[model samples]
Target: MAEVKLHGFWSSPFSCRVIWALKLKGVEYEYIEEDLLNKSELLLKYNPIYKKIPVLVHDGKPIAESLVILEYIEETWPENPLLPRDLYDRAMARFWIQYGATKCADAIGALYVASEEEKEKAAKEILEVLKILEDQALGDKKFFGGDNINLVDISYGPCAYWLPALAEAVGVKVLEPSTLPKLHAWAKNFIEVPVIKENIPEHDKMTAYSRSAREKLGKN
Candidate 1:
């Protein structure tokens, strides 16, 4: 068995974050793709509380939460060094990461609920969050942590992969080249990284999944 194992859902950006960090650090892991609708007993056993994916099992010890798992990967395998060495720089990165994790995530999550007829309002909120990420957080940086992809970049892992399909499904356009120039360029560059490029779920696969999920949500 591989020393490192990741319990993830293929279409989940959270899962992709863990996957990217592991691959970037050259960590060989056995990925277990979960069916969110029918989570496995192993997943339940590993992450008994949250029971959510992006769980990294190292030497049989499971670590839950994507962001938490990411820091673990950085600490355990510090070869590539995802976070900056400087304390202040690392703190800045962590701040941006945590902010998005709390506020932006809450806004984006509203897209999942169907009965909320104010889709545009939700989209506007999500766009405003991205706007801050671009203007205040990201700016003109090629990546979140300057020239190199760091923990901060890894934290925003889902934006590059799923945002396109999400925009399509929801009838919105947030990550567009014209709308968010710097961010759009960053997304392109972020995905081009070899570690990320190899492990991302196929576009068609994710789009199909998103559409299906939306349909199910619409019915209820």
Candidate 2:
């Protein structure tokens, strides 16, 4: 048995991504919550350069970056496979994972501000990107890896868990059933998965935190 520990912010999608991966693999680990505003000295020291949460400390060695951490976990546990077994399929999975990561910041930024015009523009752009995901990546797949969730779904973990709360906080309906039917439905299904369901932050709690963050930033 190896000592496994995680440093993360409870409300962070990045943290949640790692959490979901570990749980999906049935790996035992301890969770250490971090304060983003006042990052722990340990977190900064462990991840000196980035100073980001969701760092996995395994047997005393630290691994940062949620996506990279995910690959490490999948490689370590190997029980429940997150990436596809085929080489090409694996590459495709990684490609989509990176795709989601690139788009998420813009999607989230839209709601992070309070300007009505900016909000609308952000929402529209975000939804447009999301539409491409549904139309191309997800299509009619029940999960990113077919019947079950995979690294691709995990990569988009934040979008599934946090988008609804953000929509409420920003008072918009961007992920509507009509607009992004497949993506919206996939989000619902993804959150309902056992591992993700148990590990996610509470809905109301996230809403409050999101609202407070926006207020602090003078977004409202």
Candidate 3:
């Protein structure tokens, strides 16, 4: 058996992505929960550049960044594949995942710390980015990977789970049936997956945490 270990924080969607990938692939890994306030020395040692959580250590090699870890998990396991087998499909999947990482994520983060006067603008920006994703990448597919969850889905896990909590915390609605219906449905289906449902952070707890984070950000 391969020695696998994961360093992560509980409330982070990025950490949840690694957990979901490991569970889906049936790879056994020891999970180490790190406090973001005071990061573990091992975490700092492993991810010297970023010093962030969601670092996966397979055997003795350490891989940092959630998306990078997800790819490593897929390539390492290869049994229950998280990426598409087709070359073009794989490329497209990666493209959408990158899009979410770059475009959608910024808007969502902006919304989280937006002032009362800036709230509407920030919310609109996220909605617009998500709408593009819904129409272009997702379309009518049940999942980003069509029949099953894949890297794309895992990459956007925050949009499914954390975004709603952040919206609630910041007093704005982004993913709603009234606005982005398809994406809204996608969120519902994504979370209901047994691996996702079982592994995700508690919603109420996350919402409270987001509220506190927003307040702290406001102070800064």
Best model per lDDT: 3
lDDT of 1: 0.85
Each model's TM-score, in the order given?
0.94, 0.95, 0.97
In candidate 1, position 183 carries an lDDT of 90
Tell me the deviation in Å of residue 108 in model 2.
2.5
Question: Candidate 3 regions off by >4 Å?
Answer: none
What's the CA RMSD for each of the models? 1.6, 1.4, 1.4
Across 37-72, the per-residue lDDT of candidate 2 in tens digits comes to: 899988998999999988999999999999999999
Q: Write the per-residue lDDT of candidate 1 for residues 1-220, one digit (tens) a residue.
A: 8998998887889888898888789899898889888999999999999889978999999999999999888899989899989999889989999987988788777765534476778877878888888998789889998998998888887888787887667666668887789999999999998888997888878877777888887822
Find the candidate with the highest TM-score and give its number.
3
- Backbone-clash count (model 3): 0
Ranking by TM-score: 3, 2, 1
Q: Candidate 3's residue-wise lDDT over 26-56, tens digit each? A: 9998989999999999999999999998899
In model 1, the worst 10-residue window by lDDT is: 111-120
Residue pairs with colliding backbones in model 3 are none
Q: So what's the TM-score on candidate 3?
A: 0.97
